[model samples]
Target chain A: MLTLQKPHRHVETVIHSEVLIDCRIENLYYGDFRAIRDCDLSIERGKITAFIGPSGCGKSTVLRCMNRMNDLVQGFRIDGQIHFQGQDIYHPSVDPVAVRRHIGMVFQQPNPFAMSIYKNVAFGLKLNRVKDDIPGRVEDALRRAGLWDEVKDKLKSSALALSGGQQQRLCIARAIATEPQVLLMDEPCSALDPIATRRIEELMLQLKERYTIVIVTHNLHQAQRIADKTAFMYVDTSNSSRTGFLVEYADTHRLFNHPQQEYTLQYLRGEFS
Target chain B: MPTPAQSPHVSQSNSMVSNHSKRSPARTSPTFEVSVVSPPSTTDVLVDRGFRGLAYVFAWLTIVLVCTILYEIGGHAFPAIQEYGLSFVTQSTWDANNAQFSVLPEIWGTLSSSLLALAIATFFGVFIAIFLTQDFLTPRVERVFTTIFELLAAIPSVVYGLWGIYIVIPTIRPIATWLHEHLGTIPFFSTPLSGPGLLPASLVLSIMILPTIAAVSRDAISAVPNQLREAAYGLGATRWQVIPGVVLRTASSGIFGAMVLGLGRALGETMALAMLIGNSNQVSLSLFSPANTLAALLANNFPEAGKVEEQALMFAALILLAITLGVNMIGTVIIDRTTRRLTGGTS
Candidate 1:
């Protein structure tokens, strides 16, 4: 019953959007269902773009669409254009395996592979054949994710032994080890406590200078504190049946404070169910 | 806390209402109050009645059967036991006219052929199991292959012996000839393959035991948890890495148990060795030459042996039983140690 439709047409400049990821749009499908309809979005480089919405709003679906992670899901199909660094990701000549090597991902749950702590971070590097000086690279990734000192001595221990917070950091370390140009995190801190969430937020702030980050988060406050750009989505339940839509995307302060849409205002006021 | 009194009048009135309902007539309505009776306790019933006494009867029946066999064979061999005085096992030369027989050659032939069979079965059977369990084939193709192999296990030993004599010999003769010419310098194949011998016997026995090793090893490999495979894949480990590093290491102990079971079966095989081993009592290391296995020797010559020869045959039977039972005991120990190691690490 919450619609993110703007009351009237408005134009807001997306700074440096033409130079960043030039994403083209078409409908995306999950079998017979039209999950994302005519979605056209461009992400500015080196800035945090948070996809914010209630449950089943297709925000995460679009986020997965960005990295083509939906290929792992059975019967998932996309009819759209997603470009990374001016390359068509879905082109016939392009290999999804190679695409993943360049665009790294962190999943919703902290899924560090069942391996030694060092090997978990070194997995992508090894796959890409970045052979020499593996230990130093793994240590550097851990340090960047703020997990070095606690896990330095336990490099050979099972990654599953780490706490949930540490495991999430380890996943982040693993994603960055590939030296990817873009990082897509689908709800990175939803499983963590507030303190842990704050640590991840700080890590993200530090990482934005190096990697373009796209995060899908349900926490409005966390998004406000961390995101440079925000995309708000909601269900068009006027028929009490139709799925959802992403109605507005703008700079963080504008999206949270002064919106042109009634639904956006109600959502910001926590009045919409 | 103090108990509050409802006064005697209220208590009496409340009790009267309940009693009135309790006294309602059963003639106009169905009976709602039925008592439940608990079943008799198992222990009490068992204690009241003694065991069926069939167990005691069966136990005594087994003992009597064993005693009957011992009595029959013992009575038959008693004269030889008195005459030979334990020399029947040590002396190898058999002279029917003089009634002098020795079993040393038969014992040597039995051990070498069975051991050679075991070595071949262990090598090839384990290799086959690993190949089938890996992702070398599509799932449907793998299923067909597995079913065919499983059927191989069900083939009777006599049929295997017949096939070995009729089919396998002609097929493998070229390889045997090649080995005789090329690897004949080796002690095991130094002699020419004039006819069936220790090599043929071992090859036949290996074929008989191959199915067992493959089936058991396949079961053990399939029993490895799917989570382990997924975890390895998630680390971007290739098929080879996952198989050797995770799957095989996890299933190694179980495969070893399977191999030992196959070895035990190989040591006791009789008809196949009898048909293929040429039944010659010699201890030559050359595999191309004729030899005899303990089971084959007993099966072929026991019925014709006189009192002295028969007692020596009984000694060979006892030795074969001891070897098999010893192998089973060691297998139990190894399997126990391996299972303990696995459970200790995982749990």
Candidate 2:
């Protein structure tokens, strides 16, 4: 196993001493195609870190790597280390299923199971074999997700009957029911209207008080609105084949207003994107 | 002076009429010309009518064929039905010399054997589908196994009968004897006959229908969307957890439909059961005792039956047809209800 020492360039002055996840992705490939190259970044504990880039820039790929969700894809292999807390998650002995239990994920589309709302929220708890007070824990999670009051009377109804926004919130409740330490969202609001988008943004902001968040989005303004730290990635077309690399990483306000790299500045201004 | 007055009056009249005609062009000669054109060509009209006639004829062909078969069978069996007056189905005696016939034993045999076959097929078929469709095997290997299963269905029924008589019965006789010795307290395994009987017949029928059930079940399992699987795995479900909870639940209706289709095939089987079931006329509790199904009875007796005896056989055929149709109707209703529930009643 490769253990990476904390790199010197990590921006520690903006945050306190707690660093929850430190990612150093040397390379990621699918079959023969390289997707991400030489990417390194750190996630601050209990804060929202956003990965902002254009489409096909490997932003979602990096986010999936955090919880080892990319292992589901055939022929997907990673070459470097991803350390969660102090332990190497990519080591041979670590089971991906157990890794996912501690780090939950919400996809771009709201995919509640083909079951009732109560079952959808309780699915994770049952999988982990929780022995007592399941209904209480489910209601607590639903309340935290801002969905309990709306769906309190009809928990037995099908989840598909809910509106798009409510379904997304239900998905959030399902993810948080297990009380994972880290939450990964890959464009969680890309499928919702603006009003629903704002609600989820507020929810994410509230969730940051308890869990570390890593989000991937093509909506630059959404990243600017909620992220504490932002990482900008762009496709590297200088080589024979295109691969994505991290261009700049900084506090969200600084990266948006006064970007350090020329590419990041151009991307912010929507110049030739 | 007279010519100038006349010319002014004529020019004024002509200008007034021309302005009126321009205001109403929609009702004038241009529209009239379009309306006066000829109707569609004779060949086009004839071809359209011909195609419609052909379609009507094809649609009625199935109805006509069914009515004819029913009419012929009813006409032949009318004497037997009138004479027996439902006793044909209630009594078990089938003496050919005195022309007294009954199908009670055959009815019992057909129902018990087919139901047992269906139960066994459904149990193993669902597991096979789940195994083949899951991530346990590579796609190439899965394809090979699927092809081998399909080949089982393609073999002729007579071949299965011959194999059952030669290999399956002899091999299973010992086990049947052991079952009689150990579990004989249960009526199902009570008697120990040394030859072909209901147990071997049902086992052969189950093997024959296995491929059909497995194929349909595999299709059902594969039809479940990837999103459902992903949702389950994303919530940290193990492979075992995801299968029965998510995949099987989603495919339950389809599996039920597959079992019904296999039952239909089993109920109609003739040569295979005739060869293995020992073709006896007794209704006993022991599966080791010899028995006769309705289809096997027809196949065995239809060859040299007398006039009244042939009518009895036709009556038996009619009963078989009615039962199969009833089973299919029930299956369709259940499948419809399940599909409607799954789709939230829109279907």
Candidate 3:
């Protein structure tokens, strides 16, 4: 039987090379409202993991926990462990800024800073104190994000002049400029058109070769098309208090075709989405 | 062709025309308009016209008041300006006994003192705004502190003058003396502090303008979008880095506006400066030397002046107004240019 049980400490350490992130969330709360119940998930290295759920299911909450972005919220508390490369990210000694330096995030809306495209990409490099070969690194990041060809001619022009799809690509380039290992994308294509969406999905597929990508999306077709593994989360209202929990997680084809849990089946069948 | 209502074809065409007019108001002629029953009553028309007339008058009051003030001041200042010609603003002599008055010394005093006040106010005000708006204090504590700072502006100018004389002068005397003894080679700090002078007056002016700068700056900093701060943090920027790199950059134009407002207040301030500044009609480089701004001179000698002296004071007032207006205009232009650049505008 293939059981998704918690691995022991030594066993996890032994299998650490296979997994890039291990999220074991016991409970998460915002103020007095419980947001997420006990959940355990493992993200494979160099693969795309998609978190798919309805609104208010706390899928983005779990994604934010991976990079400790939830720490910015007031009265946000978590009682769990998210281990990145065999180290607990929430440990007292871990600096959030240092953690963020290694993990980058792309937001739902393409928020290019109110500056030039080159400066947007160089912001992270400068913050990390990358003094030497900054121009080369910025060009390299833009090329990898598939934006260099479009923006190379106007590197000094304001980023606000770019089209919506180009701006999203610029944000992606900005995030990866510092060479972060993991990229968390929260609906990166939600604000994009169909063509832009396809382009970004293709870019993500190519990016997974070098970076571990975790994405939260409401579009199930997008997950089925690009994700290697898919995790389904549902609002668990069995105990009177509503909180989200992991329902089923498996390889993309199996999760969509043969969901094991009744909730997953209902969600897939458009009965209780 | 047809007996009006007897012919079916003629009646049908007439009905069609009525239906078309009903469907489209734009197709109806002005003389054939529908009156929708009763018109407005006589009392309503009267009241409407009356209200509009009042609003028009109120709107024109500002222009009328400003023109009146300019005319009166110009008329009084004409004699002095004609007598001195261009030398009225260039030469630095104010012998009222000989009816010789030049605005050079007062112009230097006003510019130097007001500029110094603005510099000091901007330095402390920006820091105070940063402290108040950031996460260093709780919201409740921040409100209390902000209210206290606002209260500083409510204190009258004469009260500030009294405080400067009794408390501030004695307190800063020792520090001024020490600075003069140590940094004496610097011309600004060379003179020894003996009594009320330019330094005390400027200190008092800075204090008076502090609340204006602080309040406006606090509002500007608070107006910065939280998303910019979050974006900076996501890029692994520390709090200190985010402040200068994001918050200050975004709020720079508004902060400049706040400083200009403080400068305006500093230039026009009268009672406190009249009492604190040793009203001597001379220009000196040392901060400890006695000086007189145009405002202080007018306040000191306006009541007991002869006809020519009065005209001279009026001329000084006109100069003060011109300088303040020029500063405001230049400051606004600079701020506008900076904002345009920040927003990626070509001009």
Highest-scoring model, TM-score: 3
Candidate 3 per-residue lDDT over residues A41-129, each given as its tens digit: 99987789999987888999999898888888877999989988788989998888888777888888887777788999999988888
Q: Which 10-residue window in model 1 chain B sums to the lowest lDDT? A: B1-10
Worst 10 residues of 2 chain A by lDDT: A1-10
Better of 1 and 3 by TM-score: 3
* Model 3 agreement with the true structure over B131-205: per-residue lDDT tens digits: 999777878999999999999999999999999999888998999999999999999998888788888999999
Better of 2 and 3 by TM-score: 3
Which pairs clash (backbone N, Cα, C closer than 3 Å) in model 1?
B91-B102, B92-B102
Candidate 3: pairs in clash: none
Which ranges of candidate 2 are over 4 A from the true structure? A1-17, A237-242, B1-60
Give the alpha carbon lDDT tens digit for every residue of B143-249 in model 1: 89888888877888889888888877777678778998999889877887766778877888887888888889888888877645543444445566667666776
Each candidate's iRMS in angstroms?
16.4, 23.7, 19.2
How big is the positional error of residue B82 in model 1, measured in Å on the Cα after superposition?
Answer: 15
